[model samples]
Target: MRRKEKLVTVQLTGLTHKGESVGRTEEGVVVFVQGGVPGDKAIVSLARKRKGVWNGFVKEILTESQNRVIPVCQHFNYCGGCSWQNLSYPAQLALKEKVVIDSLTRIAKVSVNSLEPILACNQEYYYRNKLEFTFSNRRWLLPEELQNDVIDVNKNALGFHRPGTFDKIVDISQCHLQIDLSNQIRNSLKNYCLSNNLSFYDVKNHVGFLRNLIIKTNENEQALVLISFSEDNQSEIQSIFSFLKNNFPQICSAYYAINTKKNDSWFDLQCIKVYGEDYLLTNLHHAKYCIGPKSFFQTNRLQAEQLYALVKKYAEFQGHENVYDLYCGVGSIGIYLADQVKNVIGIEEIPEAIDDAKINAKLNNLTNCSFLTGDVKALLNDELKSKFGAPDVVIVDPPRVGIHPDVIAEIINFAPMKIIYVSCNPSTAARDFALFDEAYQIERLRPVDMFPMTNHIELVSILIRR
Candidate 1:
């Protein structure tokens, strides 16, 4: 019960976000054990206590799980990239499906029969189209096994921060979860920064030049954006830019934004153009989408196409029904389904994404599609209903936090014939779905593996009138 005192043998039921096992004691104390799979009997060492939950590491695995497999990635546990690498791909998919079903039934008051089969992705690895890495001032020190022979922590720039330790960063050469271009950009930037004597950002002090690097590739275009804390010397930055342009000509657009904030997120920052063009263009089938540094796009490109296709299929538009797209980032879903419907209206909170969405609509000559910029809850209220009229079909694709209760109430109040809910977080979606349990009957649910290696998965559910 006490920290570091109880060396108990517990069975790991499942894995958590930190690649730890989900186990519970007889007295209902939750046990989170590191490096143990489901059905494994693990001897754990208690690490800390937080809000009554016990965190620990697996000192020994007394019995192995039948489903456990050898992790494929060389930097599996240390890299903080793939949490479910130890789990077989099939098992991972199965558990994700179960998580969706359980979340809906338990939290949303929906039946199992209402859910549909998960659309399994053909390719699991190297499906990512975008990868972002922060350059850390301090390199992560190796364990005692290789401590003496490790690289100097002060001199080298680290690639990604390790889990639960913001101060420590692991210098990575490659990540198999992303395509080849992602690794190339990360590795190249690290080398460039090192050679140029550009300082990497220190999380503790919040100082340095090379802050964050974001690489995005599309069917026809690729973009690399570097955000720095401060631009002390413009000529030096230009030299770096020239080298990048010469080396990676495929990068049509390269930019650098100046953000002097303490937070890692760039939601609010005055971005300045440092090089090349302004935006990155991505072609999705027949449609084209413009991506800004602040705009939101699905990280997994191939699976996103499938996700949009599934959403379109569920919409069942007859070129007459008017559609409403909630949380439409860059209007990817709205634009994709625009031709099928008479008119599509997209509502988003961020003004920047809405601007990109407008540009995308104009680029595609989608006169039928229109976008409004405002918060979801406020936009879906009386103002939206008065302006656009009630839609025939409503498509809601909220963030990981899920749809707010007020927005859910608005959806229920408006009462569209068909409701298509797309969610990245099943737990929150299920919670939000419960609010409309009385009026709408769960028609079908499909899970899409947007992120293959990690524990995260996307679920799309369609609800019909009872």
Candidate 2:
């Protein structure tokens, strides 16, 4: 038996972190409604009812919100890549800033007078330096796009997956997030695969020529890595490699990864260099960095420079202060800041990333910086205090999950003079802010628009020991 649905008018309060509207019933039961912005009165249909939480849909927009904007992409509603497309760019920045502040206060237990002006990307579109597309047979079909042969897609360079459909993919010709070269490379590869009768990877059957496609670019240099699920034959592999090298001469590094596994693990796959070089090298500001097949580099290089500048400005180097960079990949930040400080120590979990970090340090001729490959928690335990002692300053550039609880405890125990927390996820950063509340005070919260045309934002916060 279906439960009776209840209709309610919600006075839209503000935007939630996920870009949904915050609303409540007369009984004060909180509700989150999609497609409704802040300050918009809407009639919503409650879909799910629980003890104190409710999920619903915006049945009617009773009042319009001034911050709403026309989404540029046609697949804005269905695609999983973008959430804030319907909101104005200025409004997006404002909401992002507010989210960061709220997270710090609510999660980190820290208060701030005001956040610094959000760092807006110079290029709102085509800013992503890298893109990864998944492979699947099931493709989504719109009402007008449905046909007899609409079930399985033969070949596709599907840009991204839909929100909840695990098997279905959204085939996109051009993604505004990446540069023009990515689209060109994608189109060229798709055409080549289709013409040669190459079979794309079938998620159900677990057999295919191509498993994943990754494209990265920095300045004028670009690198393309094709990850194949199974490459049992050498001749067929070399044939595709030769064709790519011959056609795309501009590709600085052309390589292939053979990942033969039921899962997405590519740890054992050999990186076969087919063309120009094994890696692509580029300069970020005054430092040089190298990128291999698996090494992680920031997607937005120009905006990254701006972010690094902010880090440098806040460091207030006395010319001999020692700095520790947690979660340092390729030692980019440590190497860049080597000259400004006495010595910089970097810690990362991945040994490959640590190897690249050391190589990059050597490439930049920065002998003062050293990278250690080990769990940050253990390093912070015995080595950090015994060998290096407490750092004069520390930089935490953690992933989306934010800093580990142990690391947070270590930082509080050590109590550095200045600490910089760089994060890709604002909510986690806000949570970590509360954890650091016992010791540090928030000095600045700056949000950088690394990924434009999407809801994702990069936030860098500077904290000082109380």
Candidate 3:
């Protein structure tokens, strides 16, 4: 198909799941424009066309929407971190609620009994407890910099990857996502590397010493810094680790890993502790958690507490009810509800997460929680149920793609009294819920804005067997 080069004016009516603004051409063709707000008239340049849908970029804002607002971040436009930052928080919440409703009704063809008001974040910016920045040799240049006669700019960047560009990174001066300590740690490391002539990772060529930096903070103000390097340079690693440890007394734990692999996945890779304890301590409600470098905790700490509260509410766990937490990462949800239920059985695929789950259960001194490591689809069978006893309530917190078909089949076979589903992706949740509509009736749904100023929203659903 020939690419559409002509610029077309569109009246954006809504926002898409990927944070793009939705509009239709005069002929009824759908167009998704990036950085376009709803209820705005924009001139968009079409970038790609496929199957009656056109993807484009906003070329000119002919009429601004009432929902539009000036973004606080200077890197809002070029950096893909916060696409909905231009829209007001209330507008963002409304659009997200609409997205969930559309996904449930239109995609899944399921009716919801009730939807509670979206739980908004108390603090919007800097609500994220974790942030990971990439080290790239070729930084993405802005439009003005590209047009400059003298193209003199620092090529080394330690920030997020540009949207739709894997090899290119945006040089961030200040990121509004995480706490102020994150910015300080990132900037100090970047400056130290640049001044010491340390190499940044060349994503295309796959060569460099510095690869990625990850910073995680908990509710208690304890921080953990993890540095991933492509090559093992002990001297350089020790120097940087020591520098961060001495400079930032708030960093309770410091770890480093040598990841020579093609991808940035270091979960399976061994992480060497360079300073302090091997794990950072965090508490939610009354339960304590030990967070390792590879641990899976919710990014938004404050909202996570709210999300877990909703999960607990939907589960409706009585003191004698046995609860099954499926796809339980680190047993956060199960452990949170351990005290309320008779016994909590947590199942996860990753062994490391299961390990963390066990540690967390011990840390909380809960003897009723049992965490098993295996695929939910394979492990959730009649034999497993016989061994673990039938669950009175089942709480599932699946990944973005939602639950597997086989897992759904297993869940149906188990047929717990109540099923509480926690989903990060609404479309997949809707689809999965549709499958359960045959045997279960939807009772209540609560949407939580765990990530503010972003298109992503978390949802909790309650289902009772019909």
Candidate topping lDDT: 3
Ranking by lDDT: 3, 1, 2
For residues 1-466, could you state the per-residue lDDT of candidate 3 as single tens digits?
5554689888899887789899976667789998889988988899877576899988999999999999999998788899999999999999888888888889888765577888898998999888889999989988788757446777999999898888999998899998888899899989989999999999888998999899998877778999999978899999998888888898999999999999998876898899888898887777788889999888887788888888887776669998999999999999999999899999999999999999999988999999999988888999988998998898999999899998888888888999999999999999999888889888999899999988998998899999
Q: Which prediction has the highest TM-score against the true structure?
A: 3
With a 3 Å backbone cut-off (N, CA, C), the pairs that clash in candidate 1 are none
Q: Model 1 over residues 1-466: C-alpha lDDT tens digits? A: 4233667777788877545678976565789876777888878877787777888777788888888898877667777787777877888888888888878778976778877778877778877767777778776766652547656435455567777887877778878866677677678867887888888887788777777777777755466565555555778778878878778877777777677778778777666676667778777777788877777887777788889999988777888888899999889999988888888999998888899999999999989988999988877877777778888899999999998888888888888899999999999999887877888877878899887767887988888866
lDDT of 2 by residue, 173-260 (tens): 7777777778777777767767787666676777876677778776875655554646566776777667767777667787777777
Q: Clashes per prediction?
A: 0, 4, 0
Those runs of model 3 whose alpha carbons end farther than 4 Å from true positions after fitting are 1-6, 25-29, 50-52
Clashing residue pairs, candidate 2?
A: 107-434, 108-433, 108-434, 109-434
The local lDDT score (0 to 100) that residue 422 gets in candidate 3 is 92
Q: Cα RMSD (Å) per model?
A: 2.9, 3.6, 2.3
Error of 2 at 356 (Å): 0.9
> How much is the lDDT of residue 234 in candidate 3?
94
Candidate ordering by TM-score (highest first): 3, 1, 2
- Evaluated at residue 323, the lDDT of candidate 3 is 90
